[model samples]
Target: MTRTATIIGGGVIGGGWAARFLLNGWNVQVFDPDPQAERKINAVLSNARLALPALSDVPMPVEGKLSFHDTIFDAVQGSEYVQESVSERIELKKKVYAQLQQANPGVLIGSSTSGFKASDLQEGSPAPENIIVAHPFNPVYLLPLSEVSGSPRNTTETVERTAQIMRDIGMYPLVIRKEIDAFIGNRFLEAVWREALWMLKDGIATTSEIDEAIRMGFGLRWGQMGLFETYRVAGGEAGMRHFMAQFGPALKWPWTKLMDVPEFNDELVDLVANQSDAQSGAYGIRELERIRDQNLVGFLRALKERNWGAGKVLRDHDAARAAVFHAQTDTAPKAEPLTMAHMQVLPGWIDYNGHMTESRYYFANSETVDAFLRLIGAGMDYVAGGHSYYSAETHIRHLGEAKLGDRLVGTIQIISADEKRFRSFVRIMKGDEVVATVEQLCLHVDMAAGKTVAASPEVWANLKAIAEGHAGLALPEGAGRAVGQKK
Candidate 1:
């Protein structure tokens, strides 16, 4: 419907959110105070320019325009949703929300703060009921998750409605049951980070070891399934109760500490940096990003065929995207072919240089003939049944340029036909002017013999009847040119 999404920041995350909405057909207006906002946005847009086009399942509508605004109020005037992604400070968010509310009371507002409660930011607002917290991770366009949490003071329906919009734009919207700082996903990450940091502080494992532990071992199991679901599977025949009875003691081991904040100092920083460099071998940020994208593409594509987990979501999204172009799934069947089913020129029939390649004209005429063959009882079904007509020789004469947008029609008249060999004269016309002509001799191919073979009895009868109807017509000048030219 050409909905308007107003973004109040142009940082990495904000720009990603912009790409998601814009790529899905929303007109976006951006309000950023940073002097380098446009530069940063351009960097994000460049990535999106390649990515969105490559994975798009169908033709996208025209690219959405991005407008820059000097102030949040000016930007939110007609916006459907005002995404406030300014500085993480509570005061800054409150100020932005105030500006948004003052501009438009009906507009829904979202803050991009990771751990801030909506109430803290919405307290001093006139329309606190419409403001919610929506925290998305880095590379927002690629990652599907959005931790959509909101305070009770906000309208619950509004938050739910906003989540639906997020889904429409291809996001995984997880609603926060309780308005808590550092919602579900980050809380899980924080728990793992705390334990990993403990190992580094004690010199028990290197940074590489911790990452390898996750990537190679249980990490993969929990990747497509959450910890609980994975454990449920592990329980196997005995299920959760029996499995927990046998292995729950490990949860209390001295090696695992639930609480320990490692002090951030030079030694700790160097420990992390050295271990990281050792693990990945000093890859640049861009290279790492490219690797991440390739891996995600591979993972997502594999998941699409099985229609499992996040892959199913991706599959559904692609289907929805395809609906734009493939709405004619049940359209009527194509027409039967006449005279070897000659076809006219399509848009890409020729190159930008404005001359049809000699090879392509023959192919186009052959396609038309193939369609007519289908009408005469030889089609893809016949080929699948181990029979086909293969062209052995052809002669073509190009009289003029087959320029772009030219509508050319082709006609094929059978000169002779038998079980072993058949000949046809193909002529191309632009209006009444003859652009080209082809005289092709084709062999009835036998798949098993890998050689010319006689046509089947049924095929011979059909061809004989069709040939007899046009027996009185004179052959074109180009006809019978194999042995000698008619001229």
Candidate 2:
């Protein structure tokens, strides 16, 4: 069944929620008084369309329907979930919640208030049990973290259901067990923000320098390992307790003015704004956003490869999506080899010759292998069970070059398969032109034992079925060719 989500605001965060839901195949209805709400939402969606899919090899679901409505009632009429992203004023939130409740008493309402407690928002409200805080970070469509919490009036079921809905849309829902003013993520952010403001106020560091201190230092570590774990490593052989005992005294030092907030006078505003301009004023907001998105995509993909933190969430979600895809198409006949994967040539894939580099062909072929593995039901659980396919050998034949911005598709043909080994050919195409071919030989391995082994019976059956399906097709021209020519 198709699900529906309604967004109450069309600002940056609201638009991001819309993109996340819409891209995940949820029909979206947006209500905002801003006359340009549609334009704003579409712009956010454009960036999302470019960045989000690059995080995974699995194909995304077809985009769901998007509609704009002027009245809040019209938008929330049939929505199963309503996300309120209007102004942060409590009065405004309460008003919106009232209207939302009136429109649909049974629907769950998630408010995107950064600082307001869910209990405060639910105060003096009918159906307060249905309202919960679902705070999300900026660029919501790309970032996976969504902090979920409930007010005192809210039932446990409300929060759990909200988290499930968030997971369905490819978000990591961190449920805050207790209601707090700013939830968890924003509290950490607020601390950093306050400290940064102090630095600016004291002339200790410029905006750029503060940003560098983060991006070049702890930021990278925090992206995957996070604070306690990163610090635990810093603690050395003794681990977290030893490190804390040694460095805990530094917490009392006057190195940080975290307890005090700088006054937001005009002079301070101008000072900060001027310094920010000097730091990054050259690039427009959109250009800066693109740069940020590209960097994030690259880092997230790296983490996905290692199956750590947010990358693990992405990997798990991709596996689920692949399962649904295989289930839906299970009855379909196998005619041509499966069009397993497709991707655009990102800028990083270009070489000195201004064409897609050789390494990317191998990467694309690996993704094709991943698709085939998923099709054969060899997924995370299969690998976790100490059974997996390891590439034993690969032979590549490059016939043409693909340039940056070119869209490439990979097609897979099963050549042969047995209990312990399998071989396949992947053809890389730019549109209809064949650009390259990769022949791969793989061995099933017992990961724990580090030795070759026969695949599970089910996996072998699936591979045999695929090999038989492709038997009628002509073998790829270069299927068994060697790297060297015959003497």
Q: For each candidate, give its TM-score against the true structure.
A: 0.68, 0.78
lDDT, candidate 1, residue 232? Answer: 81
Q: Write candidate 2's Cα lDDT for 1-487 as tens digits.
A: 8889999999999999999999888999999999999999999998987788778666577678999998998999889999999998999989988888888888899988898988888898878899899999988998999999887788888999999999999999999988888989988988999999988898899999999999999999999999999999999999999999999999989898778899989999999999999999999987898899999998998999999999998998988886775554333228568787766676567788879898999998987788788888787889988899999999998989898567777888888888998889999989899999999999999999999988999898888888888888898887788888552
In the predicted model 2, the residue pairs found to clash are none
Number of the top-ranking candidate, with TM-score as the measure:
2
Highest lDDT among the candidates is held by which one? 2
Q: How high a TM-score does candidate 2 get?
A: 0.78
List per-prediction Cα lDDT, in the order shown: 0.73, 0.88
The clash count of every prediction, one per candidate, is 4, 0
- In model 1, the runs with Cα more than 4 Å from the true position are 52-56, 277-281, 327-487
- Encode model 1's per-residue lDDT on 340-437: one tens digit a residue: 32233333345667576677787767765675566556788989899888889888777666764354656666667777766777777777787877
